[model samples]
Target: MPRPGSHKYDIKRSRLRNELDDAGIPDKRADELANEILRNPRGLRARLTHVARRFVPRPGRRGT
Candidate 1:
């Protein structure tokens, strides 16, 4: 059994590193970012920016 929070991937780590390197990122940077991606504690949900939402009009409102 895999440990808690383990990432499941078909590709080996060396292959991933090579692919990242092939993608034009520096080897060290790619490896660091890849490790961070797999081991991130906060999970992979996209974080929203702090921008205010647009004013959406409510449907079915009575006409004044």
Candidate 2:
């Protein structure tokens, strides 16, 4: 069986992606950022900052 903490990583990452999506980020960009963070979670703060810089509001600025 997996250790207790084994699933934590997945759970945290999923939450991060969901937050980004809920905040109007695109799925493709969110996935890419999530993958990068997973690969180097040690500097997550910096990574997230970088990802934040990449986001640009959608052209129409309208919600679904």
Best by lDDT: 2
TM-score of each: 0.42, 0.54
Question: In model 2, which runs have C-alpha deviations exceeding 4 angstroms?
Answer: 1-6, 56-64
| Tens digit of per-residue lDDT, candidate 1, span 1-64 | 2233445432444565676677566789767645544455354233111111112224775423
lDDT of 2 by residue, 1-62 (tens): 22224687677668778888876679987766765677676888997776655665457775
Q: Roughly what TM-score does model 2 have, to 2 decimal places? A: 0.54
lDDT of 1: 0.47
RMSD of each: 12.6, 5.8
Clashes of 2: 0
User: For model 1, what is the alpha-carbon lDDT of residue 46?
Assistant: 32
Off by over 4 Å in 1: 1-11, 41-64
